[model samples]
Structure formats: C-alpha cells, structure tokens
Target chain A: MRTIFYISDGTALTAEAFGRAMLSMFPLKVVHKTLAFIDTEAKATAAVNKINQAYADSGERPVIFHTFVSIDIKRIIMSSQGSCYDFLDYFVTPLSKELGIPAQPKTHRTHGIQEDTGVRENYDFRIDAVNYSLANDDGSNVANYDEADIILLGVSRTGKTPTSLYLALHYGIKAANYPLTEDDNMENLQLPKVLKPHRHKIFGLTLDPQRLHEIRSKRREGSTYASLPQCRFELQEVEKMYRREAIPFLDSTRFSVEEIAAKILAETNIERHRF
Target chain B: MRTIFYISDGTALTAEAFGRAMLSMFPLKVVHKTLAFIDTEAKATAAVNKINQAYADSGERPVIFHTFVSIDIKRIIMSSQGSCYDFLDYFVTPLSKELGIPAQPKTHRTHGIQEDTGVRENYDFRIDAVNYSLANDDGSNVANYDEADIILLGVSRTGKTPTSLYLALHYGIKAANYPLTEDDNMENLQLPKVLKPHRHKIFGLTLDPQRLHEIRSKRREGSTYASLPQCRFELQEVEKMYRREAIPFLDSTRFSVEEIAAKILAETNIERHRF
Candidate 1:
C-alpha cells in the first residue's frame, strides 16, 4: 500500500534522518511515498482526514504514517473513518525496541534556535567576509595578507583542516591555516615566507608536545613524525617562534567546542552577524 | 583567548546544540570550531587529548571541550581546568531541570540496509535502483535540478522549502522543489503536467483538508482560501485528482519528521551516503 508521511512543527533534522532511513529500510519495491511538512498540529490533522478519505474512495487501506512531539493529535487521526487507530502505537513500538537507541531527551526551547536557514549561506558568508585577511603565496589564493580573518599556524597533528571548515561552516568566519613544518619549525624561526608581512593576522596553535606525539603515533605509528622526541622538538620550537613573534595563541587543552569557540570570538573581537 | 573547539564523538547534535547555546547564552565569540566525527567514547578521548594539548600551551588557560557518549568523559571535562569545566554543568543542569535540550535523542541505532549511498554515476543505476527522483518546473536551473539527490513536489504549503534546505545543509544533497499551485496543480488534474515526461522522477506531497484549512488560516484568516468549507472542498478535489491520476503521496498528518522521511526513502528506493 502507498503511504503518506506527515511531520508537524519541529526542526528539519528528523525529516533528514527519516529521508536517510527510507532510502535503505525496505526492499526496493512496493514503497511509493509522499513527504509533507506541516508547521502546526491543526494543519497535520486536516491532512490526515483528506488522506483517509482518498484511500477509502480508492478501495485501499493505506498506512497513514506520522511522527511528532505530542500524542494529543493521534485521537484526531484515529477518529477518521479509514485511518488507523494505533498510529502512534504502531510507529513507536518497534522504534522503542531498537538497540543502542537514545531516547529523545526533551530540551528547553531557550537553548534552541529555530533557524529557518541552513549552514551553506553562513559558511559562504564567513568565507567571503574574511577577504581582507588573505595573502598570496606560490600560486596559492593569497593576496597582500591583509584580508585574512584568523590565520592558524601550527605543527603537524595540531588540528587545522577540520577547524578551518568548521569556522567557515558554523561561525561564518573565514579561517586560513599555514602549517609550520620541521625545517623552519625545528629552528623555531621561519613562518610561511609569504605570511611574514601579515604576521599580525597569525594565531599560533600551541599544544603539549607529548599530546602531539600521541596523535601522530596513532596516525602513522613507528614513523619518525610520530616519535615522542620529534613531536616534543617540533612543539617546543613552534612555541618559541610564537613567543618571539608575539602571535597571540590559545591552548585548547580543556575547552569544549563551545568554550574554545567563545574564547576565540572574545579575543579576536569578530562579530557574528547571525547565531 | 581565541579558542578552537572540537567534537570527539557522540551525536554532533549535542555539540551543535551547545554551539548554538554558546552563541546565544553567553558573551563568547566563536573563532574556529571543528567536529572530527568519531562514534565511541575512546575515540572521543583521543580527540580531547589532541584538542587539550593545543589549549595547554597557551599561557592563558584555554578551555578544551569534549562531548562523548560516556558520562565519564563528561565528568572529566567538568573537572578539567579553564572554562572547559562549564560544559558538564551546562548539559547536566538542563537535564536536572527536566528540559528538552538534547536535540539528538539517544535512540537505538536500528536495522535496515543503511550503508547504501544514494549517489549514482549512471542514469540506469538510478532508474534500476529507483533511488534518485527528479523534479521538473519552469526555468529551473539544471545545475540545481540535475545535481539534486531528491526533488520534492507539492502545493505551496506541503513543506518543500525547509526539507530541501535541510537536506542540502546536512547531507550535502542538492535538492530542488517545485510548487504545485492552483494553476499548475489543476493543469495536471490527470497527472502532474511537468512530471509527465519524468513521471519516475516525481515525489508527491499532499495534506489533509482540515490541516490545510488551519494552515492557510494562519496567513489569510477568514477568507475563502482559509475557510474550513473551502478546505474540505479543495481537499476532496485534490484527493480525487490524486486517485484518478494514480499518484503516490504521504498523508503527512501523523508522521514525525523522521518517520515520514523514512517512508519517502523506502518508497523512492533511495540510499544514504553519509561520511
């Protein structure tokens, strides 16, 4: 039988999860569907009646599936002549039994923001906003090093790439990171040659040397880069370079994603246009 | 005090909630934040260490934040130095107050062939798999439609916009939606006019009459468009068209966002490609 899925007011995450689930949950046939989104319960109930009548007229008993935050409306659906009585009962039964299941822990609306938009806009905005801090390097997109938002300088295993993407995605902040390698990093001297002019834009990512050693070892065990002394030396030299250059740096040792983000914002004074 | 935030593991939803909270609840500014998606507690600890040391080196005590499935890790962060200690307090305090703050409900990871990726290099693969559906409309960009993993078609209030944006931002899916208005919708009384040539490419969304009436009332109260009687009439007419046309649709009345999405994927025979 064909099915109609209804989702009343809530974030779109549940819808996405369901979309992903539908793609792989069934045997590729006998599953024809429509996905409708309603912003309120009154609208959802109205939709159920129309679907029930349509199925009844067609001489078929279709499964009018639904999921939502409340059970008050299930009565509305159940009362419909052709609608199933146990709509919630049927859906939640097996769902509640699944292993590794995490109960939908209720949350305060204050902590949540019902953003109508998504991350792409924010990501694109930040990436574009920090145009002033960017600089040019060997065929790289660097210009005069004046357009960068926050430039990250760190030795290997210091977490740069993902951080760059995240800043772009979540904060709408453009972040460019330059790696400090063994040659210059070991001497504790050279920064990215092109980055020298824009040293003020640089922020050193300092970490405990031993921690760097562990991270490298896990990725490429037994390699020289993973050796404890190698990490220790790199970290020490990098710290010294940061100190000598007077580049403001942060220690990320005990911050949550939230705390670190807060600190960075506080220090840099970069204003976020939208939360 | 510029901070780098990291997510070691669990549902990024929790971390994401906290991120949003930080943006709103405090005076913190966000610089660069990264989520290295790890599934379990051990991997989370590993991520924390990498993040921790980076914070450790900054002369100023930086917060290294971590959110893991384990209560132990949560405890560790609560007792950790710097502002990182605040996370445990933030998460638990709300829980203690019985708030519905955790958007990622702890649900059992269930069965079904979920590893399937929806991307297809060939048209035949899409048709055979019945995974990717297309949407046709007036002067729509091929760049938008052709790249779409899923396309949604329904009347104005069928919830196409939010669903499309959600899929795009979260799953990196290219999604396009077409409005089935009174004119276009009626023109396709026997079948969706635009969808005729690409019938296999269409996915329909329809709501019950009462629900539509209520929804429409919110925008244009006490008008023909929002009247209960008009809603009943329109819903009846629409259902007749759906049945006469033999179109597939989801009731959209009782389904949660997750359940409806699941039905759609199942019906469409699409798969998810998640990293």
Candidate 2:
C-alpha cells in the first residue's frame, strides 16, 4: 500500500485535516504517517529521508500534505521525493490579497494556546464542559440540568455518552445526557419529573432497533435487555415521548458522533463557546 | 468585524478546519458562522442568503470556506456575495492525478459513517475508548490498566482528563489517566504500586506552577490546595518521580489539548487504531 504523510512544523493537525478531506474524495486504502513539530532543519531533513524511504519501499511516490511557517524547512520538505501538497501556501497569497494584509505565518498558530485571549478562554470552557458532562452523565446529577446548555435524552446504548462528550469537547457546549432505563416504565414512558423544567434544553437520540440490538448484545448477550423486541419496544416508547414532549431529536443510526453533534448544533439554538 | 463562514453539504468540519487554518495566519478578529448539512438546493439557496446577508450587514465581503459535492450547490454558494475558498476542489485534480483514480466526490464521506469498513470500525473503537477512559479515569479502575494503550499521570489540574479524552476521541487510542494527589505522599512521591507493572505505558503531564495555581484557584478560590506553594511542591514531586522512574513527561503549560495530544502521540509509540 502507498503511504500518505502529514508533516508540519507545528502539530500538523491542519495537514492531517487537509489530507483526510482530500483522500475522502477517493476510495483508496493507504498507510498514514504524521511527522509533527518538525521545526528544525535537521528534523526536516530526517522527515525527507523518511519520505524517500517510503517511496523506495513502496515503489510509489508518497503523497505529502504539509504546512510549515519556516520557509527554509518548507523548502527542504518540498525537495523530498514525494508528491507534496501545501494547502496553506497555495491559499495564502489569494487570502492575503483579499484581506489586504501580509500573512503572518507563525508556528503553533493553528492549535496553540494564546494566554489571556479568546483561545485561552475557549480552552477553559472546553475543559469545564468536559467536567460538567462527566459529572452529569447518565442522570448522575439531575439538579445541574439547569446549568446545562443541552441535555440529551435517549434509551440506553443509543449513543448518548459519546455524543455528549463530542459536543462538550469539540464545541465547548455543556451537554448532559440521561438514559431512559427500565425504571422509567417502558410500558408508559414519560420524561422524568426532574427534566420537565428543563424540557426546552432536551435533545433526543434514537437508533434503529436492529442496530440497538446488535450494540446491546455485544454487552449483555442472551438477555432480554439485548432482545430485539425489547429494543424495538423501548425505541417506540422513547420516540413517542419525544414527539409528545416536542423534543427535537435525530436518528443516530447512520451518523458518526461528529455528525450527530453537528446536526444537533444545527438543529438547536445552543451557542457554541468556540468556533 | 468581518464574518467568516464555513459552509458544506455535510458536517462543515473540513470547511471549518480549512478556514481556521487559513485565518490563523492573520492576526485579525472575525466572527465565525457555520452552515452544515446544506444538501438540498433549497438549503443551498438559504445558505447563500445567509452569506449575502452577512456581507451586506458587515459592509465587507464574507469569507466563505466551503466544500460541496453537488455542483449546483457549489455554484449557488459561489454566487453569494462573498470571497469563497474551496480547498477540496482546489486539491482534487492534483490528488486524483497522483492517485490515478477518478475523484468519487461524496457528501458526508469526510465525517460520516461507512458501514462495515475501517471507518465504522474506527468509530466503534473511538466510542469504546471513550467509555474505557471514563471508566478508568482518575485511577478509578486500576485493574484495567493492562488494557490501556497509554496512561497519563499528573497532579490535579495539569490537563490529564482533557488530554486523555482527546487521545481517545481523535486517535481512538485507549487512554486512562491517574491523578497523583496528596494521597500519594506529596512530600516524597513515588510511582504508585498499582502503576509499577504498567510503567512502559506511562506518560507524565506537568504544568507551570503558576498556571496550575490559577486553574485550581478558579475551582477552589483561595483554598490551600489552590495555593502557589502547594502547586509548586506537587509538581516538583511528580516530576522527580517521573524522572526517577524513567518515564517520558511533558510540561503542558503552553499547548492546547489538541497540541498536547499530538505531542504525546509523537513522543510515544502507542499504535493508534484510527488515522
């Protein structure tokens, strides 16, 4: 298999994003390597050697997606035996002309901490949101629902926890998730009383019964909790409650956590703390 | 302030990443707005209206970084009164030529579920890792240390939890973190007995004493636990223990969680389950 390299003088996160987005356009299987924080000339030379080695070993030119602030290091990387793509360098000129300002390329500017600024403030908000989500996970702290930006309601194993964490980590939104379990009376499910006052903040997640069955079976096989009938019945009740309570929800069977979080943000009016 | 828009037919995550990386090159303040899941022509027209409205309201052309698989939608977005940048379109021809494959542009491919493939497996790994990290957090499940790809050790408020979660969420690496607290004999700290066998998987995180003090102060006001002297002493003991035990450590004072996670991945040999 061919190798794809994401190299940068900083975290190389932008390079990874660039490569991943580009590669998503082609249905191809390839090995991935990231050379991050390649700041010095020596390190850049070493990176070039690795790229050349990959090329020799695979008998194909490796695809390199790189972003570097230092011209000298970037020049060294461009000289490597690979098909290099620098999205930053390609767009910087046009963007500079459009903004009518010279681009001030700096290392770590993309994913670095800038103290006493919005970046630092955003960092604190994300960490706090993570802690809040953990503290309120699975209805552990219902009293704090008033403080939540959004509360996720769903049956167990319908992907509440991961979605909650993704919202908190990526957007710095305080998301608390509560699972609808057997104690909620699956025969006649209702929004828990503690959640009634904060109904406006509720967003629900539901999975297809078959998908739920497979997921639950992995955890508790040969049990009624993992039974298809149980999964279908619980989903029917919870979705009915969603409509009855007028809670906006998504079918998470076809979406990743990133997509689910993005959809929730787009569907709701929750203000994201970070861009 | 000028408004920067990240518009996409899918999650808009790639557009946001592209725009943010480009914008980070300039020292300017701008408002960010994302219009995600604009798949239909009507939604495309609505997004154009939003973009045009931002241009008119600000008296400055909105900078739109967008990626759309549909040609009609792309054209509609381009027709809006904004400066548009489509990184995917710009890089596609070259990348396709390099790979010798026709670009199969698909919506939601970048951050969507691909059933029964590496993508789906990756998603499962991430969710499982998140559950594992939460379960093993703060040394809560010491018995599960053998399953951890990496274990982060740090004092209180040194950015262990966020880093652990980021490692799990972004890389699908099972990360468990243990907090080295006053219970560990702060005056003469040593690697806890539980962590001795898993020493090879250990990574230490330390922060500048002042930063730690400020972080703790936010949570506990002026308590002794939040004092500068106390913070300094704990960090000192932890760092001493890390070096004494021959564990790799990082001072996470100047980095964001993303950067810290990237640095840890670079410094360690932990195999990531996802690219």
Candidate 3:
C-alpha cells in the first residue's frame, strides 16, 4: 500500500477533503496520515523528513495534499520526496483574477475560530446549535420545538439522532428529532399532538424494512421490534402518516448522514446559520 | 457583492470545502448557494439558469466551484456565465499517474453510503459512535467510560460537549465528556474516582476565564455561576488538578471545534475508527 499525507499550517481539514475527494475515484487501499498545525519552519522540516521516510519505506512517492499560508514553510514541504498537490494554491491566482482582488493568505483562517470576526459570533452559533440539539434530542424537550430550524420525525433506528446532530454540527441548524415508537401507537399512527403546530418544520426519515430489522436486531436481539414483519408494519404506518399529513420525508436507507442532510437542505427552505 | 455557487452531482460537500478553503485567503464578501444532487440534465440546465441570473443581477461573473461525475451535466454547467473551477478534475490526471490507476468517475461515491464497502460497516461506525457519545455525554453514564476512546474533562462552558460530538461524528471516535462543576468541590479539585482507572484516555479542556464568564452569562443573567471571580476560581482549580494529575490538556479559548478536535487527535494516540 502507498502512503497519503494531508499536511497543512492549520487543521489540514481542507487538505483531507481534497485528497479524499480525489482518491474516491480510485479503487485502492492506502495508509492515511495527517500533519496539522505545521506552522513553524522546524515543524515543516520534520514533516519533510517523515514524507521522505514514507517514500523510502514504500519505495513509492507519497501523495501529499497540503495547504499552507507561509511561503517559507510551504517551500520546505514542496522540497520533500513526494508528489505534492496544493489545491488552494493552484486555484488562488485564477480566483484572485476573477474576483479582482489579491489573495491575503493567513494561517488558521480555514478551520479556526478566527475565521469569524474577532468576537467569534459565528463559531458560537455552532456551539449553541449543538447544545440546542442535545437538549431537544429524542422528544426530550418538545416545548423547545418552536426554536428549532427543523424537526426530524422517524421510527426507532431510522437514523434521526445522527442526522439531527450532523445538521447542527455542520450547518449550525437547530434540528430536534422526535422518535415514533410503540408509544405513538404504531398500529394507527398520527402526527403526535405536540408536533401538529410545528408540522411545517417537520421532516421525516424512513428506512427499508430489512435495514430497520437488521439495525434493531443489533440492539434488541430476537424481539418483535427487530422482526421483519414488525419493521415493515411500523414503516408502512409511519410512511402513510407522512403522506396523509403532507410532511416531506426521505427514505434514508441507502444514504449517509451527509447525503441525507444535503437532500433535506436542498428540498427545504430552512436557513443555514453558518456558511 | 459577487455570488458564489457550489454545485455537484452528489452532495456538493467537497465543492463547498474546496471553495471555502480557497475563498478564506481573500477578504471578500459574497452570496453563497449550493446546488446538490444535480445528476440530471434538466437540473443542470436549471442550475445554469440560476448561475446566469446571478451573474446578471450582480453584474459580475459568478464564481462556481463544481464537481460532477456526469460529463453531459458538467458540460451544461460549463456553458453557464459563471467562471467554474473543478479542483477534482484539475488534480485527477496527476493523482492517477502517481497511483497507477485510471480514474473511475462515479456519482454518490464521495459523500454517500456507497463510499464504504457494500456492507456499509464503516457508516455504521459513525452512527454507533454518535450514539455512544450521546449516551455518555456530560458525565451521564460513567459506567461506560471503559468504552470511550477519549474522556474529555472540563469545567462548565469550556467546550467539552461540542468537541466530544465533533470527535464522534467526524472521526468515529467515542468521546465521553465529564463536567467539573461546583459538585466537584472547586476549592480542592481532584480527578474523580471513576476516571482514575481510565487515566490514559483522559484529555482536559480549559478556557480563559473571561470567555467562560461570557458564555455562562448568556445562560444565566445575574448569577454567581456566571460571575468572573467564580469562573476564574473554577478554571484555576481545574488547571491545577490537570497538572497535579499529569493529565494532557488544552486551552481551547482561541480555537473552533474543528481546530480543537484536530489538536486533540494530534496530541493523542487514540485510534481513529474512520478514515
């Protein structure tokens, strides 16, 4: 296997994003390493030594995806025995020309608190959203639904919790989820009375019956809740209620949290509090 | 102000990451739009119309950062008035040569459930980690500490919760956090008895007293818990305990959750469950 390095002066998150996106096209296994906060010349020199060692050990040039603000530090990294790709550097000139402004590169601007204004108000939005989502998770705090940007409705194990947290963490969207369980009378389901007034903000998630069965089986083995027939029955009733109530929903059986959140955002008009 | 668009046949997450990293170098304000799941020609044409309308409205060429697996849809987007940059396409040939494999373009492979093996086992790790973190949040379930990859210890409002969730969601690491409050005896702080057995997995978070005061003040307007003296005393005691116990710690006052998570991963040897 080959070595892939994501190195940057800051968090190197963008470098990881770039490398992962590029490598998804290739069906190969590789080792992953990240050297973050490499802001000093000494640290950059040490990183070059590691890159050279990986090349020596693997007998193949390591693929380096890096973003750096300091020219001196980046020069050291470019001198390493690796095929370095700096996506940000490659696009900077053309982007500057198109925007008619020179690029003022700065460390920590990509994934740092300083990216927001000095007050860090935008960063606060994310923390606040996370707190809100946690406090409102799983119908624990229905009284706070009016403060939510969106509410997620789903049966148990249909992926409402992770989706809600992802929306809060990534987009600073206050997403509270309510799980539809036996308590909701799955045999004849209706939108819970508490959720009726906030129906406009509700989004539903459903999964394939087989998928739901597999998921629940891992939690409560051999129970009716983990049986295929029970899973099918619950899903059929919940989905019917979705249509009857005219609530928008997604079958999240085959989607990652990122895909589900993006689909919801694309379909809904909820405002994202963070860029 | 100019307009910027992130368009992709998939979730458009990679495009957004690329665009945000590149734009952070320049001090420019622009409107942002994302066109996700544009896998069809009709959707591509509609996206182009939106891009062209934005150009006309702003009297400036819109900056488009796009990724697409469909050549036909990408062609339609290229014909739009916006200046498009495809970083994935730009880096493909070089990366392909370095890896000795031809690029296999596929939609939904980048940010979809299909990124994992067909079993979706890696996707399950993320969801499982999220559930674990939620179950163990804020010292709620101390008996499960042995299962945590890391246990974050911090005083109230020092950013333990968001950091824990970020570690779980992004890296698939089980991060359980315990809060050090007045209940911990701020005057004479010590590592709780329950955490002593898992000392190797402990990471401490501390914030500037001023920042903590501001954060707590928002939740409680005129209380001693939100007072500067109280904040200072609590943080001072916590830092003393961390050093006395020889625990690794961070002053997270100047970092975002991403930065804090990256810093923790850099300092620790905890195995990341996701790539």
Candidate 4:
C-alpha cells in the first residue's frame, strides 16, 4: 500500500485537503497520516523521520504533501526520503522574483477569526446568516421570507437542511428551506401560497426514489415516509412543480452537500457576502 | 484601500483562506478578489494583466496570494505586477532535490469530490455526520445519544447548533447539543439525568451574558428568556456546573465556530473522521 504524509506548519488542513483530493484519483490503497503544527526544525525533522521510515517499510517512496511558510522547517522536511510535493515552493519562487520581494513566512494563518474589523464584520455576517438559516429552516418562519437571499424548496430528505446550512455558513448567504408535504397534493404540483411571491428566489432539490428511501429509512425505518413509493411520488411531484414554475433544480442523489451548494451558488448567481 | 488577489489552479479556497487569515493581522481597508480555475497559461497571463492594471490604477503594489501546481501557469501568474506570495513554489524546489524525483505539476487537485472509493467514503461520512447532527440538534433526539462522537451542553444562544453543525460538516464528527433549560435548576448546579451517562463525551459552551442576551433578544425580544438578568443567571450557574463536573468548556462569545470546533476536537481528543 502507498503511504501519504501531510505535513504543515499550521493545522495541515490545506495539505490534507489537496492530498486527499489528489490521492482519490489514483487506483491504489493508501494509508494517510498528518503531521500538524510542524513550525520548527525539530518537528519537521521528526516528521521527516517518520515519513522516511514509512518509505523504507513500504520499499517505495512515500508521497508527502506539505504546506509550510517557514523556509527553515520547509527545507528540513524537503530533505526527507520521500516523494515530496511542496505546496509552498512550486509557486512562491517565481512570485518572489516577479514581485521583487520575499514573502513573510507566517504560520497558523489559514482558518480563524482575525482581529481585523473587515474580517470581524465578515465573520459576524456569516454567523448571522447561519443563525438565520437555522431559524428559517423547514419553513419555520415564513414571515421573514422577504429577507432570504435564496429559498430552497424540496420534499423531506432531499438534502435541503444541510445545503441551506452549507450556503449560510460558508458563503454568508441567507438560505432558507421549505419542505413540501403531502398536504401540498402531489398530483396538483402547485406552489405553496407563502412561496408564490418569492418563487423567483426558489431552488429545488430532487433525488432518486431508491436513494431518497435509503436516506429516510435511516431516520425513520419502515414508515411510509421512508418507503420507496413515497419517495418516488414526492420527487416526481416536486420536480413537476419545479418545471411548471420554471424554477431551477438539481438532483442531490449523486452530489455531496459541497457540490450541491456550489451548483446552487453558480446557478442562482447569489451574491456571497464573505470570502 | 488596498487590493488583494487570490489566484489558484483549483477553487482558490486555500489561497483565500490563508490570505484572509494573514491579512486579518493588518489593519487595512482591502478589496479582495478571487481568480479561480487558473490552470492554463492563457488564464494566468490574463490574470497578470488584470493585476498589473490594478497596480497602475492604484499606484500601489497589490497583494496576490496564489496556489498553482502547473509550472507553466505558475510562471505566467508570477510575472504579474503585484506583491505575489506563491503558496506552491516556496518548498517544492527543495523537495524535488531530496526525493530525487522532479515534481509532477498538476491542476485542480483540491476541493471537490472524486470518483474514487476513498474520497466517496469520506464524503459519505461527512454527509452522514451532518444529517446525524441535524437530527440530534438541541437535544431533540436522545435515542441515539450513544452514537454521538461528542456532546455540547450550553444555555440558549451560546452557539450550540452552529458549532455542532460545523463539527459535523467539516470534520465528520457526530456532534449533538443539549440546551440547559430553566427546568435544570442553576443554583443547585445538578447534572441532568439524561446527561450523567454521557458526561465523559460532554463539552460545555459558555458565553458572555451580554452577548447571550443580545443573541436571544433578536429571537425573542420581550420574553423573560431573552432578558439580561436571565442570561446572567444561567451563565453563572452553568459555569459553576462545569467546574463541578470537570467538563471541558469554551467561551463562544469570543471565538468563531471554526475555532470553537477546533478547540473541542483538540481538548476532547475526538477523532475527526474526515480531512
């Protein structure tokens, strides 16, 4: 099995994220390990030793993905016995040359609430959006419908709540979701009275009947709500409503929440309030 | 105002995330722009011209943060008229020397789900954790208490929901939250019967009474639950209880959900199932 080591001066999330995505494309069994907070030469050396040992054991050079701003630590780790993919080095050398200036190597500057006013304001906006999405979830507060940046309309278990939360937290988009119920009448495919005025902001989610059934079964087993027929009927009717209203929609059966959120943002042209 | 450009081969999320965190340390009015999907030399050259124009217009060196794995694209972007900090180049050159293998520069190997089983497994785990968190939020469903990776206990508006959701979506941790209701007497500081069995997995969240009051006031303006006196009483009692139980806790008033989740994972030694 191939071994992958993610090394970084900070939490190593960027290295791990990129490495995982890359390794996923390769057809091989992989063992992944992370060496985070490698901000010093000693720590980098220790990480290198561990990676080297893994390489020796496997009789093949282990893959090392790293993100280090500190040149000293970066150098030490780079000298290790592995096939190193340095995230920092591959671009910074050319950049420094062009800019006529060296970058200030700083650590732990990836994810946090910074002490800057603009960053603070952005964080607060995200918090507000997250709270707003939670409060307005599952059609909880229809009175605030006008304030929503985008409204997600779907049947239960169609991946509405998670998508709404993802958009709100990540992009600072005021996303509110409403679940279509049996009361709405599947055969009629009519928009709810409360959603008619806000139809322009609506996005729909649909999924395969079997997939929807499997998702709902985990939550409420053996119930009609979790049955394949119920899932099929709801998805079919909801999709019909989407077509009838000309509301943009996507199938959530094969997409993760990140992909679903990205698609929604792209399709809706919704303004993201935060970086 | 200063200008900041986040350039990347992929989504530019890493460049933006790190750049934002670093810039937060400086007190400046900055306009941030993201040039994503810069995998081609043409795209890189176009981006350089835009940066040069911005520099010409502002008469100031614009800051550019970038991550490009393709050497060709990286070279073009590095020729920009800006203060460019390349994330990839700062280490890869040395890494190539140590490994005795030149780096194979590729593009867009970050921030998306791949077709491989390992990547799909991680995505499935995150989605499951998110759904689990949502279903178990606010102590709503206690039947699956044993399945939680961590439990958060706090008063109303101490940010239990968002933190739980963040942990689930980002780290693939099955997090559940319980709100300390008025029914749980504060002065006595007794552990509730439901939580006693899961005390080892519990993490407490505390917030400044003023912040709690403000957060709640937005939800329920005139209710006693949102009153400053009520918030103060609950907070003081919760702290006392936390001290008695030796439950690790964090003050949510100061830190963002990301920070809070990171601390919880670190302090609790909770294994994150995803990168």
Evaluate fnat for each of the predicted models and list the values in order.
0.01, 0.77, 0.79, 0.20
Worst 10 residues of 1 chain B by lDDT: B105-114
RMSD of each: 16.2, 1.1, 1.4, 4.8
iRMS, candidate 3, in Å: value is 1.4
Model 4 C-alpha lDDT per residue in residues B1-275, reported as the tens digit of each score: 56799887666776776566455334446777777767688878889998998888888788888877666887788788788775445555664454455665542355566555565678778889988898899989878889999999998889898899999999899999999887887767787889889999999999999988988898899889999998999999999899989999989776777768766765667888776
Scored against the native two-chain complex, candidate 3 gets a DockQ of 0.76
Task: List, residue by residue over A1-275, the lDDT tens digit for candidate 4.
Answer: 66888887665766776565444334455677777768778878888889889988988678888887677888899899888775445555564555455655542355556654555677878889998998999999999989999999999878888899999988899999999988888778799999999988999999989988988998899999999998888888888889988999999776668668766765666889877
The lDDT leader among the candidates is: 2
Query: How many angstroms is residue A266 displaced in model 2 relative to the true structure, after the best TM-score fit?
Result: 0.6
Q: Rank the candidates by TM-score, best first.
A: 2, 3, 4, 1
Tens digits of per-residue lDDT, candidate 3, A1-275, equal: 68999999889899999988998898878889999989899999999999999999989889999999999999999999999999888899998898888999963378777634542777788889999999999999999998999999999999999999999999999999999989899878989999999999999999999999999999999999899999999999999999999999999988889899999999999998765
> For each candidate, what is the lDDT?
0.48, 0.92, 0.91, 0.79
Q: Give the TM-score of candidate 1.
A: 0.38
* Residue-level lDDT tens digits of model 2 in B1-275: 89999999899999999998999888888999999999999999998899888888889888999998998889999999899999888889999999999998963378887875568888899989999999999889999999999999999889999899989988899999999988889888989999999999999999999999999999999999999999999998899999999999999998989999999999999898876
lDDT for position A22 in model 2: 94
Cα error, candidate 4, residue A89 (Å)? 6.8
Error of 4 at B75 (Å): 10
C-alpha DockQ of every model: 0.04, 0.76, 0.76, 0.25
Which CAPRI level is candidate 2?
medium
Give the residue spans of candidate 2 off by over 4 A: none
- On a 0 to 100 scale, what is the lDDT of residue A240 in model 4? 84
Please report, as a residue range, the 10-residue window in candidate 2 chain A with the lowest summed lDDT: A107-116
Distance from true position, residue A253, model 2, in Å? 0.6
Model 3 CAPRI quality: medium
